[model samples]
Target: MNIQTVGVIGAGVMGIGVAQNLAQTDHQVILIDISEDILDKAKYEIRNNIRLQSFFQKSDNRKTPDSILEKIDFSTSYKLLENADFVVENVTEKWDIKKGIYPQLDAICPQHCVFAANTSAIPITRLASLTKRPDQVLGIHFMNPVPMKPMVEMIRGYHTSETTIEIAKQMLSQMGKECVIVNDSPGFVSNRVLMLTINEAVFLLQDQVATAEDVDKIFKGCFGHKMGPLETADLIGLDTILFSIEVLYENFNDSKYRPCPLLKKMVDAGLYGRKNGQGFFVYQ
Candidate 1:
C-alpha cells in the first residue's frame, strides 16, 4: 500500500492543493481534469499558493517557483490515471458525479490502487458502495489552502478495509501532515463542530449584533481565534460554507445546522468570497 504516484481528478482549489502538496513531496502527480483551460488555471492557482507559502515560511529559500512547477503532470486523458498508486476525486460535491467515476476508475486502475475522495461532507460509505472495489475507497479530506493547513481527516467507510486506511494515514503523515482518523460520520469532525459555531456567528450578524469587523475583532481578541467565522467564510467562499451546512442539516435534520439566510442571499447574489472579490466583507 505504499503510494508512489497520485492521480488527482479535478482542477479546482481542493484538487490543485492536493496535487501541489504531493508534488512538493517529489511524488509524481497526474492532475486530470475536463479541459486544458481548467488545468492551466489550476496550475496557476497552485503556483500562487506556493509563492505565498514561500514568503510566509521564509525558511526554504532554495525552492523557487520554477522548481515547484516541475512536479505536476497535467492531463486531460484518463489513461494517465491508470498507473496511479492512489486516485483522489476532488470534483464538485455531487453524488451522481462521484458515483460515475468509481466504476470507471476501478476498471482501469491497478487492483491494489487505493481510491479516495476529497469530499468535505459526503459520507465515504456511500461513495464506496458505488465502486466495484469498495474496500479500496475511503475519505482523505484536506482543508482548503492545503499547504498551510497541517490537518487532514482520514475517514473510514464501512467497506473500506483497515489496510487501506492505515496506508492512507501513513502517506499523509509522511508528507509532514497530521492525520486524525474518524469513523464515517456526517461532516466528520471538524466540519460538524465548525459549522455550528459559524452558524451562530451568522445568526448574530443577521440580528445586527455588530458589524463584520467588530465581530471578528471581538472573537479574535477575546477567544484567541486567529480568524473569526465570518472572516473565514469570506476566505473559503460563502457558497462552499453554505453547501457544507446544507449537508449537515439534511443528514442530522437539525435546525441548528440550517444555514443563515444572509449566507444564502450572498451566495445567490454571486458573492462567493475571495475568488469573487466579495462576500461578508469586500475583498480588494
Candidate 2:
C-alpha cells in the first residue's frame, strides 16, 4: 500500500509526536482524540517541538513549524479516519481502552487500510482478533518521543500477512525510521526486557539499596547506557510503567515482573513523571 495520509489515534505524548513526525515528512495526518482539551494541548506541544527542532537541525529544511502545524487535521471524531491510508493507534495501554477502540477503527477505516497498535506489552494477536481484518492488524511499537527514535519495534500478529509487514516497513521508511520485525508474544522484546530492568530499579529504590540518581548513575557510568532504567520509566510515565509491569506479571504469572510498591504509590499520588512533573525524581 502507498500511504499518503496517516491517521493517529489518541492525543497523548506518543500520538502527538507520531503525528508531528508524519506531518514533518509531508504526510497529511488525521489526529483524533476523545477530548478537545487533550487535542488542543497536543497541538500546542507539536508546534513547540517543531520550533525547538528547527534550531537544532538547521540543515534539514523539510518543514517549518507552520508547515508541520498545517499538515495535521485535528479532530474529535473517529469517522474522520475514513480517508486515511494507514492508522496508528497510540491509546493508553489498558486492555479495556484498547478493546473499545479497535472495533470502532475497524468500522470506520477502509477495508484496505492497515491498523497499527502502538502498545508496548499487549499482544498484537489479541488486538487482531477484535477486528474483521485480522491480517491487516499489527503492532508498530514506537518508542517514547517518536520523532527522536529512529528505530521502531514492528510486531507481526499470528495472522499478520507478509504484505502487511512489507507495507508497514515501507510506511516507516518514508518517515525515516527503521523497523526491527519480531514475532508476536507478550511484550514482544523491548518492553519485556526494559520493563523488568525498570521494575528492578524500583526495587532497589524501595529497599533503600541506592538512591534513584545513584542507581541510574551506575548504569550510565559503568554500562554506558544513555538513560537509567528508573529515569526511562519516569520519561515513559510511572503509570504507564506500572501498567506494563502488571501486564507482564499477568501474562507470565511470575513474581519477577511484579510492580514496585513505590511506583504504585507515586502513581496513586498523581505523580507521573515528566508529564505531571513528578516521579522518582521531580521534573521542573
Candidate 3:
C-alpha cells in the first residue's frame, strides 16, 4: 500500500483528469492510450488545467507545470505498467471493451497491483469476475473534473477485501480525496439515482414539455441544484447516459430505466456534449 507509482488506462476526459490528479500530487504516473494523438491532447489539457488552477486558486502543494508534467509517462503500450503499484482503468463503458482490458490487465500488472475501474454504471462485481484478482478489483468512480472533485464513489465488489478498501482510501488520501464507500449494485448509488433524473429530463424534452433552457432553469432556480438534469446529461455525454441506462434496464429488467428516445437520437447524430460542443445545448 505504499503506492509510489500509478498507471492510468485510456486518455479520454476521465483518464486524463485522473492522471493529472495523480501527477499534481507528485506521484509517478504512467498513462497508457492506444493513440499518440489523443495522448498528446490529454497532456496539453492537463497542462492547461494546471496553469488555470495556479492562477485561480491557492494550495499548499502547488506544482509547477514542468514539475507536474515530469511525473507523468505517456505511453502507447501496456508493458510500461508492469511496475505500477496501482492501476486505474477509465476506458469506454462498453462491456466488450472492458472484457477485453480486464483480462489483459490481469495478465500484465504485477500480482499485488489493485485495479480500480472508473466506471459510471457497470457493476464492480461483474468487472471483478473478469479478472483473476477479484479481491483486488474495485470501483473508484472519480467525477468529471478529477482534480477538483473531493469525493469519489468507492465501490466494493462481492469479493473485494477490507484490506483493498483501506489501500484505496490511502491512495485517495494522497490525492486529497475522500471515498464514499458503497456496496456494489447495478448502477451503484450515484448513477442509479442521477441517471434516472437525467433520463426523465430527456423525456421532458422528447414530449416537448419545455425548452431545454426552461427545464434547466427550473431545476437550478426552483430546486436550488447546481446543474439541471439535461445539462448534467450533456456533461456526462448522451452516449454514456444511454449506455448506463441500458445497463440499468437490462440488469433490473424494469421499464423505469428505459432511455428516452431523444437521448439515443442525440448520440446517433454524434452530439456528445462538451467534448464535441453539442448535446442538450451547444458548448460554445
Candidate 4:
C-alpha cells in the first residue's frame, strides 16, 4: 500500500526527527503525544532542526522549514491517527508504557496500517502479540538524528509478513534511507552490542580507569571510532542507555548486561545526557 499520511507517536527526540524527515519528503505527518505542551515543544524543536540542517548540509534542493513544518500536524489526540496509513512509535523503552500504546493503536489505526516499533531493546514479537495484526507489526529502529542517518535496522517479528517488510522498506527508501533486515531479538543487533559497550564504559568511569574525555578520545584517536562509547551513551541519553541495559539483562539473565551504578545514579539525578543538560559529560 502507498503510505502518504503517516502517524508518529511520541514527541520525544526520535519522534520529532522522524516527523521532520517525513515532512521533508513531502509526506503528510500526524505527530501525536500525550500533552499539548510536549507537542508545542516538539514543533519548536523541529523548526530549529530543519533550519540547522539547511545551514549545515547546504543543500539547494531542500524544502524550506516553513513548508516542511506545514506538512506535519502535531496533536495530543490519538483520533488524529484514524486516517494514518502507517504509524511509527518512538515512545519510551519501558515495557509497561510501551504495552499500553499498542492496544490503543490497534483499535485506532486502520486495519491495513503498519505499526513500526522504533525501539532500542524491546522484542518486536512481544510487541506484536499485543495487537491482532501481528503480521503488520515490525521494528524499524532508526538511529539518533534520523534525518542525518542513512541506514536503519529493520527487524522482522515472528509473524511479520513479507509484505509488511516490503512496505516498511519502501517507506524507508522514500525517506532516503537504506535498511538491513534482521530477525527479532531483544536489543536486536545494534543495541545488543552497543548497550554492553556503553555499560562497560560506565564501569570504567566508575573504576576511575580514565576520565570521560580521555576514554572517548582513545576510542576516537586510537580505535578510529567517531565517538567513544561514553560519548555515545551521552548522545543516546543516559536514561535510555540504562533502560536498554536493564532490558537486556532481564531478557538474557546475564550479569554482563547489568547497568552500572553510576549510570543509574546520574539518571536518578535527572541528568539525561543531551536531552537535559548533563550526563557523562555536560552539553551546552
Top of the candidates by lDDT? 4
Question: Quick one: ranking by lDDT, best first?
Answer: 4, 2, 3, 1
Model 1 residue 261 CA deviation in Å: 1.5
Q: Is candidate 1 or candidate 3 better by TM-score?
A: 3
- List candidate 1 stretches off by more than 4 Å: none
Range of the 10 consecutive residues with the lowest summed lDDT in candidate 3 = 54-63
Per-residue alpha-carbon lDDT of model 2 for 160-220, expressed as tens digits? Answer: 9999999999999999999999999889999999999998899899999999999999999
Which pairs, if any, clash in model 2? none
TM-score of 4: 0.99
Q: Give the alpha carbon lDDT tens digit for every residue of 1-284 in model 1.
A: 66888889998877888888888877888999999999999888887888888778877444766776787899898888778898889987766677788877888899889998888788889888877888889998898788778998889999899889887887787677998889998889888888787778888889999888888889899999999888888876787788888888888998888899988888899998887798878878
RMSD of each: 1.6, 1.0, 1.2, 0.8
- TM-score of every candidate: 0.94, 0.98, 0.97, 0.99
- Per residue, candidate 4 scores C-alpha lDDT tens digits across 79-118 of 9888989999999999999999999999999998999999
Error of 4 at 104 (Å): 1.0
Model 4 segments more than 4 A misplaced:
none
Can you list the residue pairs that collide in candidate 1? none
For model 3, the superposed segments whose C-alpha errors exceed 4 Å read: 59-61
